[model samples]
Target: MNLLNCHQINELLSAYLENELDTTTTLTVANHLEKCLSCEKELKALTNVSNLVKTVIREADKTDLSLVARSNKINSLVKDEITSKIKATENLVLASSNDNSIKTSQNNIVKLNLRPKWSALSKKIFLSLAASVAIICLSLFTITYYATSTGPLLSGVARNHQFCSAIEISNIGWHKGYPKERLLQANNINLPKLDTLGVHFSDLHPCKVYKAPFLHMMYSKGDKQISLYYGSQEAVNKFQEKFKTITPNELYLHQESNLQIAAISTQKNNLWIVAGDLTKEEINAITSELAINSLSNTEESKLFH
Candidate 1:
């Protein structure tokens, strides 16, 4: 077979570089390149330009260009000579010359198909990552809210108070096991007798609220019930330091539709909470009476020093 002219060879160069030509035509082109410096240089330039276009497309994420704008940019980059060369590679498949010189252009079309697909895949990956981050942040927020709001550290004790009040009779064994005398001797916290105030003590029990060991006292008069809780100064301090909500020697009131709670921080490094099914005034009076009694006891103890 005769060797094709430069013009015919030029048309087949793109197909030749992409390996889209038949075996015979591929060998013919390779043999021609051995003798022709100009055609060989042209092939090298085409490879470099094609690689450059791919690099720019891959790095599209670094820029703020829209998809259309990016596509336009790529079109511009492959314009004139480069576009003509790519177009030549595509057309080589359709060439029906007498020599059967070319193969299919499916690979070239597949490369062109990659441009938009790559951008879309990158966007989907980024969006999936963003959604995952958002979900993690939301989970963290929910955990923190419950930890501070309704967890055992804070207002959760109100639920404990309500539950204990509902079944005060079952606590008889607890009261028998931990009497008022054992409480004062062991924990150094004397339970005040509220008989003068018409709220009579019914039971005393040792219980734990989170990490704090508390002395739970049940007092009632008719339909009114009050729960008094006391914890040591050291245990209370650990809770206060971590939560930052409790302050020693301060009063905090918490009320719901059916339940009312009052928390008192005593100067002696102890915590006291009064929760009951009573009016706010009643709860306030009980807290105040306890606070005043605690103060009087502290004063009496100081007389010896």
Candidate 2:
């Protein structure tokens, strides 16, 4: 049977825990765990954590839906009322039939008064509920806006990939430590023979991803470019959960019209992402060659960057 290394073994842990891997892979992982203490600990940790999460979610699933449904009913009614009031607020003519209730015009014009003429208790309840909904919606919109603009470096990388020439290699200032030093700093291996892709190495820039410092490198190939981003675990953990986790151990590839991102986590939990607009062939070629060879063939495919 073929033995699996830590990287390949790590990817199989989730599936192995659930008994989803094929029989050969399962046996291989079991044999590997017996000899590899580090892989063994990591597997146990991940398994314990996953089981705990599953248990919590299972308990949460058992929660009575009637309670949720009742609350949702209240929110839904308020949302509808708010929607009507908002439409009414936009009308050219704003008038209220009575200060107590919401009223609408035949021609899409509606009248909404904050101080409703309804009875004292009910009126207060409606106003309070409306105010709460307003607060919730406002908060959500604010959060969404903030999240989109928060990652300027990441956003810029994504955006720049869309353009032909967003910046000169000099403008980004990639220089600093030697390639060996930068690779060491990131706890990753630099790919040899990247010249096959016509890469012009840029200086390693000191940067932050969500305020965690990491070195950034850019490689220009004519008008096209790609970025290899490194970030510590804590900072990178805040990214989309889907991107953070992967089914396969190799560099996980995600493509967009503007960019193609190949992101993976190192053994130390540091994140290394390579993004560009290369074709499937180019991406596969780059990823295949990106990692430095490990001591054994089993760990050869594990890419730190």
Candidate 3:
């Protein structure tokens, strides 16, 4: 037969477990599994997941649903069909073990008879159950991932601004780490000079906003300080989604402690946040200016090139 890569083997694993592959392909997969540890581990994990889903389905049938008489009757019929299939599979495995004509390998691959073809109604029920399982799995994965990544970065940005603003008022100098120009160029962010808006750049330090790199630019207008934070689109999208109240380029307004904050995306979709001890109007103005200026710079660069 043919040599199958890990990805190919994975694609066949479900069918192989179901005794749906022809004998030659089944033997090939078995041989591959004996020699390949990664594919073997994957097969084991898939088996566990499959068994878990089956157990969940079985337990679901045991739930009391007497109030909904029609649904209860349907669940009863489905449970009976599933139980019969499980018993038939067990019997087939036992018969395979006892058959003298069947060949067995050292890796415990015993060929079994093909599964009996399902009736049309049986196929529909099985497919509907499979679809429900798939939907549940996808929803769980999305919720877990979103919860871990979003809803915290905005608070982190606000806290960073508050801490740094206090230090700036004390006349403390920021640590000069990476040069500002190189950082901006590497990240493809345009930090516009806000002299027109009375916000003058005071200092910039490279800092981590959660797990992503952020260019934290400090600005001053007399005694008032403003923070302009720029980071990647991926990081900012999560923060924006947490608020669930902004269009593509609209600003998200938030506050932490005494610091008022605003965030918006540039026309190029890069994220920018403006935060300070200012009113809603001031924070919104600074955020809009940064976004508009950054958008203009992007267009200008494209035109110049």
For every candidate in turn, the CA RMSD to the true structure comes to 22.6, 37.0, 31.4
| TM-scores of all candidate predictions against the true structure | 0.37, 0.34, 0.37
Could you arrange the candidates by lDDT from highest to lowest? 3, 1, 2
Deviating ranges (above 4 Å) for candidate 3: 1-160, 163-174, 246-257, 297-305
lDDT of 3 by residue, 200-285 (tens): 98777655454445677888888887787776766565454555554433334454335555555564446666766676667656
Clashes of 3: 0
Better of 2 and 3 by TM-score: 3
- For model 2, the run of ten residues with the poorest summed lDDT: 162-171
Best model number under lDDT: 3
Clash count for each candidate, listed in order shown: 2, 6, 0
lDDT for 205 (candidate 2): 53
Give candidate 2's error at residue 88 in angstroms: 77
Q: After the best TM-score superposition of candidate 3, give how far the Cα of residue 77 lies from its true spot, in angstroms.
A: 96
lDDT of each: 0.62, 0.58, 0.65
Candidate 2 lDDT at 120 equals 88
